[model samples]
Target: MLWLVPLFLLALRAVQAWSPTDSYAPGNVSCADDISLVREASGLSPNETAWLEKRDAYTKQALREFLDGATANFSNSSLVDSLWSADKIPRVAMAFSGGGYRAMLSGAGMISAFDNRTNGSTEHGLGGLLQGATYLAGLSGGNWLVGSLAWNNWTSVQHVIDTRGKDDELWDISNSIVNPGGINILSSASRWDQISDAVEAKQDAGFNTSLADVWGRALAYNFFPTLSKGGDGYTWSTLRDADVFKNGEMPFPISVADGRYPGTQIVDLNSTLFEFNPFEMGSWDPSLNAFTDVKYLGTNARNGTPVTKGQCVAGFDNTGFVIGTSSTLFNQFLLQLNTTSVSSFLKGIIGDFLKDLSEDYDDIAIYNPNPFRETEFVESNYTKGIVNSENLFLVDGGEDGENIPFVPLIQKERDVDVIFALDNSADTDEYWPAGLSLISTYERQFGAQGKDIAFPYVPDFDTFINEGLNQKPVFFGCDASNTTGLSYTPPLIVYMPNNRQSYNSNTSTFKMSYSSSQRMKMFQNGFEAVTRNNLTDDSSFRGCVACAVLRRKQESQNMTLPQECAKCFQDYCWNGKISNKTAKVSTIENYSGSISFITDSASADAASSTAAASSSGTSTSKKNAAASLPSSNSLKWYVAFASLLGMAIGLM
Candidate 1:
């Protein structure tokens, strides 16, 4: 009888979470299930400021152990010790880029290198590095890494990996979203119906929903696979209460999305980069220099002020939705309903439902009533720039190709001293990053609005690979004083691009599916790339890391450069040389980044798949990442049909 749960759930609308927007918030008032905590404007909320105070205590302890030992070999043995004072100590930030699952697992392995908990992570490894940091940021696939850890109580990535099957297989890559791989008791039909209805509820609440809503729901099913019904009641803001996050036991998790003007084909570095932090969701960029409380995201606000005109809505920032919003490019999966395993009836419903939006089908997460409605960022007030008027259209972070996660790290206020950027973008013919992400940010910094924020000068793309800068670890902004393009000191960046040393972790950016073995191998490869295989391949990598970390303190104090650091800069830093000549563009041919330790045939299959696609093309060569969708209310039947069709999907 209990096994009949799936069929029973499909038969009814099902008593579920969330009131529809119509009933939740009708003509005159806002959502009835309004959360009391309305949207407010402020800098790092008192809550975050307070949490940082406590977390800094832990960070101070972590850095004392790490920096002192890592930098002991330098001429200034006491630099880490001497700069132990609160403000002077180097503030570090680790940023992960977007590249689907490759970015997530690879970032996981690299992050694992900084975790003492991972086996052999501490020996010659920067294990305590994560603990000493102030911020952790991710975009797209990287969001999965940061979001997973935060939602799971700030657990180690290794712990996340170890507890797969035993704990409902949270990161179990074995189960595709459409097919659960038998991890849960619910049938595929029940899962689809429930997610579809929840999305429909949002639509019913006077919001326009798209395939992205479905895409986000499907992603929620995978990232938060442990929930009773695929994380039904889980909200992103709920993370605020997690003891670890609230207490600041971990790095602040910041997930990013690119704000697309409705119907825009692509994004540039100047395109507003929006972030969803535990406390709020907004862009620090002046384009929309305001952020609302994360819990009150759906509350219709006018130009950064919450108007009593609209009611506040809660639980709209579902954890899955946030992560899904960051990676909305994955919505391409839903658009391919023709080939998807879903039934044709559901397919036609989705097709008909999306037909109007299909004309301008940009895979984006719509934040309704425009939080930044009248602001300069929302050019809706201007008739010329926008093809359609919509508030808060967010797409993949790398949609602009500024994939290094620098937007959140380089904040003048965050004052991060050095950023360890894990570059997992597929920017070259070989599918390995060739410093293009860095180049984009550098170019953006030249604009009138962005000029105040100084970025390290990087060589042209051809120079990035020609000089072997992309092949090995490189340092940018090494000399803070001598740099040309800045009003202030930008953080030194330790750029570690995905390479083929341990495993060619440069899987295709479009690739979503990966076998467990390939996934683990990618993680291992990332670990080795970060630690240089625990410093075996390049023992100097460790010493260079210590040098990069201490450079800021050395600069602030006007201390002379150490001989070791001098050598590091000469060998690893870009020397203002330009090479615009067309690059021969590097490629990894027939590369097998296979892990022999795992015997799963699934991994072997995935390895063959990865190698086959390695030479095809990179994300840079693809169509615009910010493709638009239609949300026009031209079809009245869509709302009615979707309301019923969504629930009736499983039966057909």
Candidate 2:
């Protein structure tokens, strides 16, 4: 009887006819009734119906903005304040070339002007004012228009060059934005001084200077100093401790095998610079004589090997070091060390000036002169960039004669709305957990703020238990479908607050009979379901299934919608699964594909015992490895994920 109530309400709406004026009447036709009918008609969940609605609203809003000529704007003062409040910080921008020079001047001038206008009470710098302007431009289309015009005018006058020359230096100059050598020499020098000073200061403060210290400081200082000091001090340790070793004596060199050269070069850890014995085969050989091999005297001499030494030859300007019988290792090590030190110094100086604008402005806003929070602005812009970058853009294949860059015309932001119609068939119960996990992980990584509601399938058993018995049921739909023979037919509908839905169907294609708004509601509902569902358990396959279904639906709809709609949908649904089997297989693969082993070890009692054992083992291992070299596992997993996702999406 409880299950039939929604069904009955839907039935009434389906049969009843109303005039245009009466269509808006809440009592006459409500989302509750509409969703109930959808559940009865399509066998999806009420949550899914709600998802579809929210999706539709977003799609519509996007279309409207596009059609009405509006631009998206983002702001947050908290993030900006936080960034500014940091003790050590990187420089945001480096003045390079004519355009960069002009921009810097403009930024500084604008800040000064703003300060004067505000009675010189603001603590913000020139970069902050520019950031504010950029933020405003991002929010308003008018600013973009003006900016474009200004850019064009500036480029026209400053970058004019003949395109016919084989050695067109103009292109070379223009490309200097991304090129290292083309940067302005004066600016580079200034940045280097700034970085060197900062590093020296840190060293004086007795901070734990390491490779990370150097790199992180470089990033914060946004400067690269010249390497006036000799030796190959470009190694991570040296760079990190650049401040510490400012006036310190160079360490003795050690002999390094040829095979380890690549690793040494990559991490700047060449033994030629900091090894204890430059000519010795290993780290140190105390028995080695400074001039010649000493006469045998004690047992320590017998055990100790002679340290290799180099002497001046007849025609050579300086004496060359020799290791064992070969001078090759000794000579090469010295050369590498000398080159690396100078190179790193130059790199540090240059890198500081070219710092990204966002980093600089983020720090500035942290001190509280803005209306919005700093974190909000950073998150919004970062997410927006991610979304924009993920969108599809067309390119010429080069094989064809057609060599034009023409993007697909997507629907305007205001015109089209998206609805996520999910398939919540019995098969979904197996793979929904993966989808849930993905949502949870993404939310944790990116910060959850604008996500829509999710629609899930509500079975008759839960409805009956909750409504008929007036008691909450532990198992919502455990008895509704027989797990042994799960079927794809008769999809259930659940309404969520947002317009998103997840559908699980056996067929490759399924009919969606809901209106545009209803479709969005379905997607939102599915999104919510996946978001709320616990993914710690192995059975959380529901989320993955929903994600796949929603992706497919979005893709299909993208084909018929405007370019922006397609782009947005494609970006969100990128790497989405097309089949239930694929979703299930992916989830299983993630768990190592051996369900039996995982399940056996994952049992409640077994898990507790195993956890205790692992903890004990870990403690012992940590103690033993405390003095040894660091392991690669310390790198964050999110960095790896971001890299992989970036590569995949970039290629796509």
Candidate 3:
């Protein structure tokens, strides 16, 4: 999108060699013969011929130099490079502003190239001609060639002819040269003002005027060509003119008053390359008419005053009364007067509304790089039902909305137990510290209590997901490490609980039931904070680590959790230093709520002592109850049953 100045210069040079005259003109020959042919034309006057000849010579020399590559010497690569530099990115903002302005003019029928001259006088309207020239200059680089010729300047000969005096004998002849009975130019300054206001309004909205706006304005103009022909000299009279206003063509007779007409019909001129569409004002409703206030144009005009036929003073503001008109000329004026300065000023008041929109788009892209993966999530939402269960809990960490709690589904009722399974695969470098900062965050959030949290750094997903499934709230840190004789592969399954099943395990089904909303909220709060911290440290592994954590949670849902107290008790037996007597007592208490079932007196005595000791350290016991639970293994049926029972009671 960034164009170098040298490229623009080259394009400009190439465009200069293009035909200066209209390409549609009868021309089967080169530029050299074209001027002579025009001079020999029967209609052109002597002065017109002379002026055309001089202009032709100048253009020919310019074209020759451009074609010969002489313009290349003027191409400024240094300026282009400077503009393209990092510090000069602001220049793009400027170009965009200019482009916006040009589009506004194009939307207005005023984009046409025309020569205006006072009647019965030699003074030409050089200002209008200069404006047209500037427009043509802006249309270089094939911009005009490709149906974008919004405006162009009249030739010098056309200017002279258009300025000829009406009383002079040559006046009619001059008018024939300028108007040519094709396009009629209405001679009224008041009509021009109405058109100008309408065009200005359209420009404010950043919309381009179509051919309809021009045709509508032209139709309006032909109705009342002069102030003497209509009441109040309003522009709307021309629009209501019955004689000249037609749907398909210009109905009026073209004369010296109209200026050189471009085409035989309105459609012909509209179809030409320089054709511009004025903005359509559309219909105004009576109900919405009350909403019109001081901001309306021409608000200060006389009460009940009619500007022209079918147009009247509706309201007024500080600038002027708002004139309601059916003509598109009003719309065209609105389009042109809508300046970028006002737009920018309004934007300053409103702030950059698009900034947040752009940021949101970026966030979406960053979070969802793979469309297939996103689709998979969507499908999971419908079929699996796990994504729906992950709920978002807003935690108050007291840092003024900074703190977040990240608890896995397995440990939803307790503290997080994260096991970082670091991948030391062949693709990973040994220098990369694995999951150290992640461990630190857990500690920072949970303090010394976090030490009980589990982190099993593994080199592969098989061990991390299968062996580490039961380790609730586990985190894994892995990379391709040649030192560990591991190869890189995805999905890495990095963060997982020791009790959760592997993604590829046939017998090991996942058990957690967290929902996508919950996961998103959890990730938004937890991982986002972690990523922010990592960002400060210039860490590049946050994305990978965050993704692994999400995947682990997802996989855990498919694996089943211990359904019975006995299974839970056994699962946690090896996780702590509990005596066998205490374990038996806890299991029995969980299931039957008494020790009467124990047949042996010594067993009962041991159970009583163990209960006494646990009650004495009730606070520590409460903390260790969930923390001391070992990862679940299906092999130990009896122990698993006891552990499950113990876990059930512990949870209560």
Candidate 4:
């Protein structure tokens, strides 16, 4: 019965909620509306700066309300008022990592934990912190989470969770993208027809089309099920007109991508990183050092203006297309063609397209009529090829090893004081993170790519595992004075890697489909991991989060850390310890592990005792592996199966 759901939905339809339209296709348009649409990437855009002015008041109040809940643990209760009254205020940011659906679902759970709007999130969790954040950045799969939330009128993650299991609801990943059919209950063939029509429209309009268009179209069906044509008519630039965004009720959302040339197989640290915000799309890297209007993305421009007088292009930057560009690395789906249930005719069409795509590069999002062609800027290794190119090639943001979207938040103009980096990367053989992404990002700061940016010192990946930094929340960039040879002070990084808590959440990134139970378990595990078992393991986690946010503001004012917060920093901050041993989780208890608040000791004891009893009676192969490493044959099978699937699908 469960297996039939996909086919049933594909064959039947109750509503014609959408129809094919050329709204997403590029078109020639007038450019005389505004002269200030494009500008140099010298600093924050006027629109963002003005929006921040309004958001500042919102964050101040949010921080106050959040800190008030934790006042019992604070030595200085009045500090919040003092900090808000001062000229400098604590600015916060949250960055979600890339790992396809794993990242999206895990990040969504963490978002729910951070949002005070979610019921019960404030009990023993770091709730209300999302409201205090100034910037939200995502790359690849991470983009899907933030983009979905931002575009859906800034909806709460709880709302999405509540809609699960219903037909054509958001986050109903019952069917894989390769066989996508939902919302309108069209057959897989029908869905492919719609996707083909959209991409063909872009191509027919005299613009380049790639697999990214198809990928984004598939993603749209899951993310925007209620919208017309599943959001085909929607554009990412339209977020600029949303009331929530214009009123500064939500944090600014940014999606990140990396630039690549045709036929380049490897993306290194020196690759230019570009960001797509509501106002514009561009890079802060010194090479191009410019930005242009995101609404008129297809317009051929030189020196920050359209090449043709009083003429430009519009509707080229579709919402799905923009999100897909950040995750073009997912084109590996072609490699798994035989594994999927896609129809033979559709397979042939995709196969033909992949043949042409592989000649250059399969993983790329094509942007014809380069907006920065011949733009006057400093000529460097990165700029010369970009300015001369007639087309722009963008790829996955994490293709360069920076899985986390930290580059945008660390900019000097943004003035972010702290960053909560949610890392769900599977860097180890067992699908656990080994802190390799952070190491890559740290190494990047010393290269030419780190022109105006500075990153805090980070140890090798070996130290990350040997010291258990990947298993819990660890603080980086704590001591500002220690960071030398940099143009600006880096934000304090609250690195929280996904780990086992109430549930083992080390699901493989390529595992696209999940049962409803698996989805809910992952969400629960994410909340437990972020709150560290609802502060049962360490009650000071909430206080520590507050302290991390207040670190830079206090240091700027030359204030000492609070008594409890000082102890928290000492336990959580890495103390320059290094080890040559191979990567492994540490067993050391950094803090006093105590469940002092006996809210329900009887139930807690019952849970542990029952779990142990169940484990002894059940086969080890089927039981949840609470420990880090895989010990059962079933898990090994999962690893092998996921590896094959990963090669076949290669999702973000």
The models' CA-based lDDT, in order, is 0.65, 0.19, 0.19, 0.71
Clashes of 2: 147
lDDT by residue (1-652, candidate 1, tens digit) is 3423432332122222222232222123254443333233335666667877877888888877776667667776655556664357778899898877778888889899988778777676778888888899998888988888777657687766676455455566654444443346456557666766777666666776655566677777667654555565566776666657767778888999887655444455556678888887876664445566776666665544456734665657777778888887533334333333456776775666554353465356777765555543344222212213345677778766677778778877777889998988776655787777776666555542253466766665666777777776788888876554356788999998777767778765545456677778888888888787778876666667878887887788876555877887887776656544556874232111111111112332332233223312221211222433465443334333433443332222
* Poorest lDDT segment (10 consecutive residues) of candidate 4: 590-599
Best by lDDT: 4
Worst 10 residues of 1 by lDDT: 590-599
Scored by Cα lDDT, where does model 3 land?
0.19
For model 4, how does the per-residue alpha-carbon lDDT over 496-547 read when each residue is reduced to its tens digit?
8889987778776656766677778878777777888877898878888888
RMSD, one per candidate, in order: 10.6, 31.1, 36.2, 13.4
User: Could you arrange the candidates by TM-score from highest to lowest?
Assistant: 4, 1, 2, 3
**Candidate topping TM-score:** 4
Cα error of candidate 1 at position 434, Å: 1.0
For model 3, how does the per-residue alpha-carbon lDDT over 357-457 read when each residue is reduced to its tens digit?
22222101010010011112123222122112111011001111000111110112111112222111111011111222222222222222222222222
What is residue 248's positional error in candidate 1, in angstroms?
A: 1.3
Clashes of each: 16, 147, 123, 1
